[model samples]
Target: MPGFVHLHVHTQYSLLDGAIRLDPLIQKAVGFGMDAVAITDHGTMFGTIEFSEKCQKAGLRPIIGMEAYVAPRTLADRTAQDNKELRHLILLAETDEGYRNLCKLASIAQLQGFYYKPRIDKAVLQAHHEGLIAFSACLHGEIPRLILSGNLKAAEDAARWYLALFGEERFYLEVQHNGIPEQTTVNEALFDIADRLSIPLVATNDCHYLEARDVKAHDVLLCIQTGKTIHDSERMKFRTDQLYFKSPEEMTAFFGHRPHTIENTAKIAARCQVDLGFKGYHFPRYNPPGEERSAEEIFEEQVRSGFEDKWRIILQKNPDAERSRYLERLDYEIRVIQEMGFSGYFLIVSDFIRYAKTNGIPVGPGRGSAAGSLVAYCLSITDLDPLVHGLLFERFLNPARKSMPDIDVDFCINGRESVYKYVVDRYGGGEYVSQIITFGKLMTRAVIRDVGRALGIPLKEVDAIAKMVPEVLNISLENALKQEPRLAEMAQSKPEIGELIDICKVLEGLPRHASTHAAGVVIS
Candidate 1:
């Protein structure tokens, strides 16, 4: 049995649109004896690293890609008509250069091309097409749409244009079967076009959920996404229930007559090889003034001088205090920091904190494990003294862990923006800095309410059902149902309640949206 690779699948990081989660999705792929899978999340690479790592752990090759929203005109063109019209295209990374290009595209899409969605125009794609393999995506793709609209020549022209732009070897005509009547039409046209143009036909299932039974849950997810009830006459819906993670055997059965379509998936999967640079830290380069002292020397000098100043302040208050203990602890922590090759990291953080304090921005005393570091205290990165507090420096940064130390700094709400501005100014502004991304998930109670609403349950009833869920962090729907007997009884007694609970259970813990991380800003 020849295995088929999933080149166009969505994970929960696709937010409300995708129901399949990363861990279970990867596990399912491995269970089906799949050798490779690709996550083409909508307009973002948020899940690429996590998906790649999970796939590697499961002994499967991960193809990194995105189902990008391609703007009809230039990305800068935001006319009312153009704002709502965007086509779909799938871009897979074939090398490290492709991965970098993907990042650039995603960043530009979110930061500049974002109107109703993160979008990129063909111009942007042409500029960043190096090391990438592109697919004329699902029915929403330009070629497929053109074909479905009885525009065969236009469809062929569109396919030829992409083939020219991405190069003949890097472009593919994608075919899918999700039980939609229009898909059959599109696939037939694609086959004809592929035959004429010598373009390979790649089969994809467009997986949105893990199993066939998940169709109902995925439907509810779409309703939640569109703010509509399932009973609505006019609402966005998948025309068919065939969008599950299909096995190689199932895929072969679906496209067996055209075996090459199935085989091309494997070929495309083999071509993609992305390294996420997980082995080491890519810390931003710290440019020291005048080159008089290296970053390490300047870091040490600052730490020593700051420690002496603190020691002098303490000496004035308590003359009999032992300096040897403080000095030994400071030296040990400094040695550990230097040994870890984080001297520049410490200096960069300390420099910003100094700037914040000097400008009258109220910084917190200390927060998280970072307060445990004596070196942090010496550099004024934290105000808490580890010795007095009996905090272990190893907790913050240990030789055994060998990971980058996490230092979470809290700034006063009113002054936070100013501090961010100062960082941007110091680091050469937006070109060198950007905020990190954050994702929001479908928590147990929230999912229950959402599912109930989508199922057309009354708000009062939905609220009552949601209220039965225990207010506890990381508590699952199963745990809540077990803990609250009344909720279980209601689910068993009422058909609506039972359906809502079942749907919520499937959707729980899936990501609902993405936003900027509150406190994380990347310098470079």
Candidate 2:
């Protein structure tokens, strides 16, 4: 049988929807003799970097992509009457330009187009379609929905529109054989459209888990996602168990008659070549207000000026304070920061902290290794004197580390928004600034409680089971089962207890939801 790539694979990063982890997914792909896999996680590219790096190490090509939600009208439109429906589209980056465009589209969806889900409209897609390969995604995709609604002309028009935008070589009519009754009808219609428009058809499995037996575990994950019981008839569920990652032979079994469709998966995977340019310095440019001096010059000037002011107060507090030692430390730090290409970073942090203090917004003196920097103390970014406390500046900004220095700042909850606004406005506005995204996963104890609740288990029993999982940080379910003999014995003695533990074990560590990082923000 000819080799086939699983282009619609989702990993744990899909956030409670996908049950497959990257390690097992990579293992399965290699074991199946396939050379590539695609991660089309719903509405986010959270897993792309990890996926790309891991796949390259394992000698498998990672096609970085997202299963994006498209709005019915303009992305900005939000109304109860006319704009509730969302369409799915799979977008893959074919080059560095495509990767950038894909990132732009995802950010626009997140910052501007969010409603029930992050979404984009055709207008934005058209504006940023360069170097991208688009696919009419699963059953939820635009063309499939149009075909299902008995509007062949609209479906054809939609296909042609994408074809014209991405160019014929970059667009494909993606078909899946998941055994959903609608998919059979959708695939037939897609084939008819593909023949008429001369557009190629590509087959994918829309994989959500790793294997056939994992279907039940994935179902439990869906229950946790929807807050529904496995016994609930109306809860959201997959219609078929065919959503697991299938081997090339298995996929060929599903689409044996259409060899070209199977072959198209490899073709698409080979075409997508994205270089994320990892480990490059990406600090935002910080130009001082109305000053023609370079960042290095401005940084040194502020450090020396602030040091003199700080030293004067130090002399008043302690008449024996050594001015030369302070000056020497300040000069050393400035040189290190300048040589490391981090002068702008220090200036940016100092600017915001200064703004906070000037405006009566409470700020933490400093925290972590950042307190070890004399530059931080001079700039008022920290309150502690490294010399008095015997702190090492190299601990904060070691040249040997060869990574960006981290400085953690704390601000009054009520006034932090103002500080953020000041930075945004000072930099370039929302276009150049955004908050970082963080994921909350289903930890061991929390997963037990959640699974028990979804299973309709009594609160007392569920709480007892959850408490049995040791209160250690980031403990896994398997470890908990082994560490607590009572838990393992209960699992063996009682079937319901065994079932509850079983489900929780599989659902643990998958991302439960996404939220903005509390203290971190990204600036372009």
Candidate 3:
């Protein structure tokens, strides 16, 4: 009864659209002694890695899910003819297959159905919705839209469709109330439909950020997103002052009259028995033909070939620059690559890059520590030469410690798929290659700012106070206030300032959502 999980959350993985910061949100949830939390970021699972990593470290149950935008029809609907826009759908990975389906669904949504946001159609859902728990999402959710349009029968029909896809036990009616009039109207009809259909009901706060007061900054953020002034009535919006994270106590109080709704939240959590394990690396595959050579052999060939070519460059450039310098570096790099058992990784990257260059793909000159290797230069993995650029090969491969050497190759965004395809073709693509997952945690400062604003903080005051704290990434407001004299002075001089920083200190660093990294493709 005391511990409650945040079932719906959005961290910055919602990008600028979500104000929640991961560190603060997770910390706050723990501080409040909450049991578990769900990260249902809008559209993409970009934050999954960060969120899950932190949650495991902090001993919190991390629920992985996405607030998907449903495409009106199939994303393959190629007629430029305007189609009725789709609704919001909440998809949670309940099993390994569900997680995989979620990834494919998210990928396809971005690749094929990107209209206003990443989206998937009913057809796509029909294919991959198995093993996923479905929730009828925010007011913009499909069933709510039907009810809002004054069609109770239509709303029931929509619920029936989801119930059929996910089964009664796996699908829940997501009811939220942020004091919006539309929410009130929809809840009434939603409950009616759930009762008629014999479907379960769950309560969600539709948390956009961490705190209520953050609503204003989030409003300002909305302004930033749309290029609209804060005063515009025509702007697309959240439409409520009440979307901040509420404590279990507060949540219970909000649904005091409807205790069943509050109880249902815990019931849904009980039904959601998901255990996440980070047992193996989700490496992108480096395929090779079984008849030609084993993957290991192909990989070793690339490294040996790369080292010889690098020796050539060094010998040519510094005919007398010390042969020991070239040999010592090459021997060390090769040894480390072999020891880590990642010759496959190096070869896989090299093969694709070689193909790209041969096809005139205009790959990046170099980036990261890989730019510092002579072997990389000679093998065409990178254009930068350590001998010329005075780069360090140790940065790429350190003999002192072993870690995967991350060499990112960038091509024109439009033609990057060809490069991806080449790698998939060479390395066993589908089974071997898998994208890494990350998560977004809520943190202090941001959450308190959100809570303060939701309860109502003047914008000018919030800005002035936020400016007083020194800007340091990854430090909580509590630490910032203690370390910085300026923040200490400001808090002492102003009572409201003290309150603002005080509350943010409590809510700092909770896992508010999940999202994917931009280019953190893991190659094993």
Total clashing pairs in model 2 = 0
The superposed Cα distance between candidate 1 and the true structure at residue 481, in angstroms, equals: 1.1
TM-score of 2: 0.91
Query: Who wins the lDDT comparison?
Result: 1
- List candidate 1 stretches off by more than 4 Å: 288-292, 321-328, 388-390
How does each model score on TM-score? 0.95, 0.91, 0.70
**Sorted by lDDT, highest first, which candidate order results?**
1, 2, 3
Better of 2 and 3 by TM-score: 2
Model 2 bad stretches (over 4 Å): 1-3, 30-34, 56-59, 73-85, 314-328
Candidate 2 lDDT: 0.88
lDDT of 2 by residue, 74-138 (tens): 86678863244689999988888999998989888887888878899999999998989988999
Name the candidate that leads on TM-score.
1
Which residue pairs in candidate 2 collide? none
Model 1, 388-430: lDDT tens per residue? 7789999999977788999988889888898899889888789
Instruction: Give stretches of model 3 more than 4 Å off.
Output: 72-85, 256-260, 267-279, 288-291, 301-336, 352-401, 407-524
Q: Rank the candidates by TM-score, best first.
A: 1, 2, 3
Better-scoring candidate (TM-score), 1 or 3 = 1
